[model samples]
Target: MAALITRTRARWFAVAAAAVTLPRAAALTARASALTRRSMLLGAGTGALAAATSAAPALARPAPSDGAWAKHDGAFAGVEFDGFKKTPSGLEYKVFEEGYGVKPTAGQGIKAHYAGYLLDGAKFDSSYDRRSPLGFAVGTGRVIKGWDEALLDMRVGEKRVLKIPAALAYGKRGVGPIPADSTLVFFVELVAITG
Candidate 1:
């Protein structure tokens, strides 16, 4: 009877030890799997960030083309006419209607209505469409070089047509709807000198 009880107690202790050890081993395995999943996710996130930065180009102004002058001259040929006078900086203009009101000075503000077009006659922008006139300081670099130079000498109610060279307009890389190396034309009406 004593040998039977000792054998039964030894069997019970072995079964209890196995039950405790099995649960601990399973917990360790689950912890290791969770760590591995976290590492994979972190690595994937870093790779995606690197790929996104490499795929996008840096934001910077494009360099002007060497053939800007040649392109401007070719575009100018289409509108070559008498009475158009060229400024020292290659801006061509013709005042179709003169105004008697005060002309805007360099720092003075002016209101104007304008329509912009490309050399091929495609309209790019216009203040008339929006029923709003543009207002800016004259010769303050608030606008393109051509507008700055022309507006300083313009008076209120004056209407002029400007043929802007590429350098005086949007340069080699033009804005939306205007192609690279394009020359611009504008029919500008000086509505008022606000300042």
Candidate 2:
């Protein structure tokens, strides 16, 4: 009887030991899994942050071909006519009468009233109704070459119609309400020149 009791006690102790160890092992495994999951999430978040930081400059940079220019005189050039006054640099415009103008210098700002339409007379953009001049920068590739040339010779209070070639306008990627590579016609009024 004594030997049997000793054996039974030993078996119970072994069973109790196993039960306690099993819970401890389970807790350790849960902790490890949680740590692993946290590490993965942190790594993914860091990678995303790095990618965005690296790409910011590229996103801010403007494209060279953003604004189209007409091919004239064997160069991607533009022409100016009557009502168009050329500046001393022969690359700028200061209008003294009613006519069209283009903005030059890849990044000068312009304040003008404008009426834009398709060559077929389909109207697209207009600022006259707002009784406000539209402000835009030159060559920062906002406007095409034709517009740059046209604005160069225009002055405050000058208005004119402009015929823009496809090469100097939207090119293949036309903007809202404008077709790709379609010639544009604009009636421009120079209200101010702050750039």
Candidate 3:
């Protein structure tokens, strides 16, 4: 009787182990199958179909080259102003109010108040409407690429106007109210850095 009980316990343990291992083995097999299929498709010159079927976000439009900003003639066309600076990534900004405090680094949470508009002066979004500041991590792509690049240089209490090209803002597929390939203007006030 004692030997029978021990055998039963060992069998139950083995069964439980197999149950856990089987699912993981199945998942790995499925992943391998998908990769093999993708490889075959690529070799067959069906790269586009393979990419479309893959789990990557489709780029709505190609990003403009960094030098493309020089030739850009959009809403900000012919507008000249002093103190405006351009980043290497083509983001442009002018500080209106400078604040004194520690500047936020990448991955730090920041609170900011902002009103976003199209170049034609149509307001599309505002934190003021929600009666609260927008909060996001600085330089971590939590917001748009432009915001991530611009916020890094800002100090607490700083107010600035950002002229974001379409690629940095939303690419070709604009958000609800904003139109595709639209240039955006944002009046931003940094409220706090709360890492």
Candidate 4:
């Protein structure tokens, strides 16, 4: 009788110990799995939803080709203008009105009223709508690379149509109103060299 009770108590203690340890072990495993899943999501670029609002995504896109530049709608859509000039860095622009006003250099304060568009003639943003000119320091990394390069070449009051490649404009991740891997166009007018 004594031996039977001792065996029963030992068995119960073992089962209880297993029950307690099992849950802790399972909880630890779940935590580890959740951490690994989160890391994998970040590495794969399907980043955390909260982070996506602030973080610029990795450049998963390649340098742009001429396909996006195919005009979907515009008066000059089908017209191949000979005046389109290319910069060595692949920015394309055609001058509409070359003003005699001041041209900006590096670190110069400049202002412009511009309409931004995607290649499909979708307007994304415009300072013109707000009745205000956009102002920024030229060549100071304050703006996108395409904008900085364009601003440097532009004189105040000059108007031009710009075809900015994805790499120069937004890379793989575009900001608000712009889509990922997009090529952009702009009908930009240099309002003034603020400096």
Scored by Cα lDDT, where does model 3 land? 0.65
Question: What TM-scores do the predictions have?
Answer: 0.59, 0.45, 0.58, 0.59
True-vs-predicted CA distance for residue 64, candidate 1, Å: 37
Tens-digit per-residue lDDT, 1-195, candidate 2: 999999999998877666555455445334323332122222433344334334332212211110111111221113333333333333322221232234344466777777676745567776765556678985465667777777765655454556676777778997888989887766666666576
Candidate-wise lDDT, in order: 0.64, 0.52, 0.65, 0.64
| Tens-digit per-residue lDDT, 67-184, candidate 3 | 1112222343334333468888888887644456678999999988887878776777877667678888888887988888888888886666788989999988978999999878
Segments in model 4 whose C-alpha atoms lie over 4 Å from true places: 1-82
Candidate 3 wrongly placed segments (more than 4 Å): 1-83
Which candidate ranks first by lDDT, i.e. highest?
3
lDDT of 3 at 64: 14
For candidate 3, give the lDDT of residue 22.
42
- The TM-score measured for candidate 4 stands at 0.59
Q: List the candidates ranked by lDDT, beginning with the highest.
A: 3, 1, 4, 2
The C-alpha RMSD of each candidate to the native structure, in angstroms, is 29.7, 28.5, 19.5, 23.7
155-187 in candidate 4: lDDT tens per residue? 765666788889999999979989888878777
Ten-residue region with minimum lDDT total, candidate 1: 60-69
Clash-forming residue pairs, model 4: none
- For TM-score, candidate 1 versus 2, the one ahead is 1
